[model samples]
Target chain A: MNIFFFHLMPYGDLDLSYTDKYDSAWVTLPNTYFDRSKGTAIYDRYIGELSLADELGFDGICVNEHHQTAYGLMPAPNLIAGALTRTTKKAKIAILGRALPLVNNPVAIAEEFAMLDQMSGGRIITGFVRGIGSEYFASGIDPTLSHARYYEAHELILRAWTEPGPFRYHGRHYSFDYVNIWPRPVQLPHPPVWIPSQGSIETIEWCAAKERKYTYLQTFSPIELAQKNFDAYRACAEKAGYKAQASQLGWAIPTYVAETDEIARRELQPHIEAFFNKFLRFPIEMRMPPGYSSIASTKMLIERKYAVRASQQTIDTLGDLGMCIYGSAKTVREKLLHHQKEMGIGNLIAMLQIATQPAEQTEKSMRLFAAEVAPYLRANASTAVAAE
Target chain B: MADNVTTETVDVRGLKLKVQQAGSGETILFLHGAGGSNWTGLLDRLATKYRVLLPEHPGFGRSQIPDWMMSVGDLALFYLDFMTASKLDNVHLAGHSLGGWLTAEIAIRNTTKLRSVSLLAPAGIAVEEAPFGDVFLWNHEQSTRAQFHDQALAEKRLTVAPDLDIALQNKSAVARLAWNPRFSNPQLPFWLHRIDKPTLLLWGREDRVIPYACHVPYKNGIAQAQMETIDLCGHAIHNEKPAEAAAVIEKFLSGVKA
Candidate 1:
């Protein structure tokens, strides 16, 4: 499958023993624990790991946005994408993505993404997200208006990129008298749009209707659940009068590789555990704010009970559940290949750099994955070929 | 008291509303807080003196929320239409928490229709010193704790499990109305002066949700307004101290001419 390296750029030095003092790693977490000097070193190391991934010939490098959270330090993924444009060559700069609802000005997104697309020489993939519910609190945006704002912003950005703007645009959530953008995108029509979701049906249907790529964020869920969601997405696309190709489907999961299974487990298990039990330890209220999700979706979520299990996940449980992949290069390769064949996912975005994982360890995992795992998968599979 | 309470569905404009009506005399409309609509003990105590009309806001309980009804102001207008359709004039108005905010909006907009306004722990005034706690961010347990001074009473009230669908529906409706500008209207202080009728502002001394400091702006802005603090009470003053809340309302309403 097409391999992409995803970086959360986490503050690896967080004292796990003291995580109990904070309600979550998100909005309410005290900033006193964050050391600026340590943060500077972490950024350089994380970005250096991404640069290594580029040198190792990964198909893409992925970054995303989160607010007021140690879960991911990228409040602005665009800036990171811009930095990647200057440092990395050939690998697509995938900002997966900018949270559309949290942003006050949609045109600024249009302008920035266009500038990045031109700077990267048409090697940019734009991903749009309705930020997680905690972001509504951090950004002071109404969670009730999230869907409306997201759709409006998406429409505004697309039109600004394609249509000759400076045209008046009026929407329920936004209104612009003079809608014009300079330095229009290098990609014709627009850069390819991808959407990542936790399998919200509304989002799946929207993505299907728009004929955009849909990436399932299998965050701490069982493989069967992801498969069911993928099936639903394919069915949704079919109902929209088009069959979804493998390239239109993607899977993002935590992955780590090493020389042997024992070594991989020994080295990565603690970091993986901390990532789930600590970094992702958000209270239910913070994760799903009032009106952030629909009644049907909320009811479905309650019935499934995935979120409860996710909160209590241990490293071993996560691995057994297939929420994460950690093993020898051979074992990791086999597992990924099985997932690709079974789920029909063409793109595999591997999150090698986890919470508290050393920079040297991340680089070693990337090199092993690139040398031992990716080459075999690339040679044997034709359907997993990159869309570009 | 239990036998006296009866429930009915009333049509307001195109929306259907579930209303609980009790006793018979001068009409008194009781608006409930953000916590879904229910028959509370205060309703029964008030029912003994005057007819208490408790209608679930358009989106709460068994009510049907029309798409156009999106804000607290829209709810105020809906209630106005309900009064007009019911052929009631110079009716007494009372509300709690979010309901209190709605009552103020109605009073400001339709000054002639109401005889007096009673706001119990109302949440429409912005106070810098004692900012309102974010109820949406709190879990059911945290919210219950913050809403009551008596933890035992809160525990007793919150023991029963909530129906998931109804809980989600109520929370969603509350978010639609009060999520932005948070719980208060920035322009509400400017318009409170328009409400010329006698107003009663009841606050809980230990209300951790909407602070007691919110009383200042309401008292200062409205003419002929009286402010009272209920000691050892919380945001749900009516629920926490039903008898006292009822007695205060009864005394206030008795002096006003309807």
Candidate 2:
């Protein structure tokens, strides 16, 4: 099993008192709270931390995009990935990913990724996202056209990379006179594409199609929900006349590990509490908006994720549901190994640096996860591990 | 006020449009707000003297969304096609909020069949002075209560019916039309002058959704428009002050006919 370090790079110095003042830590949270002096230093520290993850022997490092919100500082992940390439040597750099429909120019993305792929010496895994609904409010892209725009952008980007360029590429949402991207990618037929989602059914089906069997990464969802979605992906693959590989399924989970289970929970309590309560307090409208997801996906998400606000959830409840995992190396490893066997997850995207977790604490968790938990999982990858 | 209220599907542009109508006399083609409710008390009051017609906009309640229907401009064009298909002449075009925005768009484009246009708490252009009360940011309940000035009435309405699923579906339709511009067309003020038909602009003094500040553009732009404001009312003027709103609109329509 390959372990990847995923960082949201949130405002670590966030004044939790904003919980009393704002609707959420997202779009509505006043920017007055973003401590200016600590800004560049945080980015400097975070990039250094990701580079350390590469040094610490993690197989890959992941970054993603979000806008006008403290939930993620990276409005542009490609730049961060570009910076990481100069700092880190061997780890796969996954911009997991750029919001496909938000950009007016998919060709620019083709260029950017191709350039990043070249910079990273062919070790780039591109992840395409429809972006969150809040981004539509931020970017003024029509939510109703999200599905149409996303699929079109996906095809256009693919064609830009594969098809010989200086060609005319035209779609309903985007049109380009020249399809040529200058920095041709190092990886032939384009770099590997991974899709990280909350398991939108359409996304699952799309990822499983025979022509494009991208690795489907389920992020920040309950174990049951993740299992159901992965099963659906396999079913989709079977219907498409192919059996999905174990490597095609992945789970991106925020995890913390320590010497003992009690110590781990105690140390992670406040950070985990603030992460769910403050950082993830997405009001129904702000999160889903209107026509952002299909009604079916909306209904499914509401039932699983949104029905219970993160403010009401705690470390215990989140852990029980498999939304978060924090414990001793033994407990964490056993749970991961059990779930890996139970649901064919060949890739483990561990988010060791949780929200508001201090720099020192994060470093401790990362080292422990790397030194203890990851090695056990790697050693027992294909074994039929029994649940404790 | 009338016992003859009836509903039938009108085939417009290959989609069955659900329409509710009552009474006789001159035709009042009433378009609903973003809320997309059926036959309100305001319409019932108007129905006593004029034939009140309410066609559910596509993607609204009980109305199947046509594949090509995308924006308020498209909906405005659909209503124009609806009028021609229904063979209505000398029609009084009336609409509320999103519907009011559509009324302005339709009249500006072509007013040959319109005798007068009534826009209540219209939302077609932004008011720089006061920000649009962003319902997209507020929770369903907060946004719902923000719609009315009378808390008791708002509470009563919530107590009776608070279906977020249905409300969300309607909002989805609104997002398709109004989300991009944040509920206002940049060109609306420029074209408001073309709506030369006898025009009425009614606003609620305490409206939080569109704000009373927004009425300025409509009042100043439409040369024939006479603006009126109702006290103790919010954006949903019909829900909060149906009788008062109906009385003002009734008097205006009578003056237009005279």
Deviation in Å, model 1, residue A26 alpha carbon: 0.5
lDDT of 1 by residue, B1-258 (tens): 478789888877667788889988888999998997877888889998899999888777645456676788888888889888878777889999999999998998987778889999999887999999988888888898898999998899689878877887788788888887888889899999898988999999999999998899999999989988899999989789999999988999988964
TM-score (chain B only), all candidates: 0.97, 0.96
Q: Give lDDT tens digits, candidate 2, residues A205-225.
A: 999999998999999988999
Q: How well docked is model 1, in DockQ terms?
A: 0.76
Could you tell me how far off, in angstroms, the CA of residue A314 lies in candidate 2 after the best superposition? 2.1
lDDT of 1: 0.85
State the displacement of the C-alpha of residue B97, model 1, in Å, after optimal TM-score superposition: 0.4
lDDT of 1 at A320: 78
* Model 1 pairs in collision: A166-A179, A166-A180
Q: In candidate 1 chain A, where is summed lDDT lowest over 10 consecutive residues? A: A211-220
Q: Which residues of candidate 1, in runs, are more than 4 Å off?
A: A210-220, A302-311, A383-388
Q: Please give each candidate's TM-score.
A: 0.96, 0.96
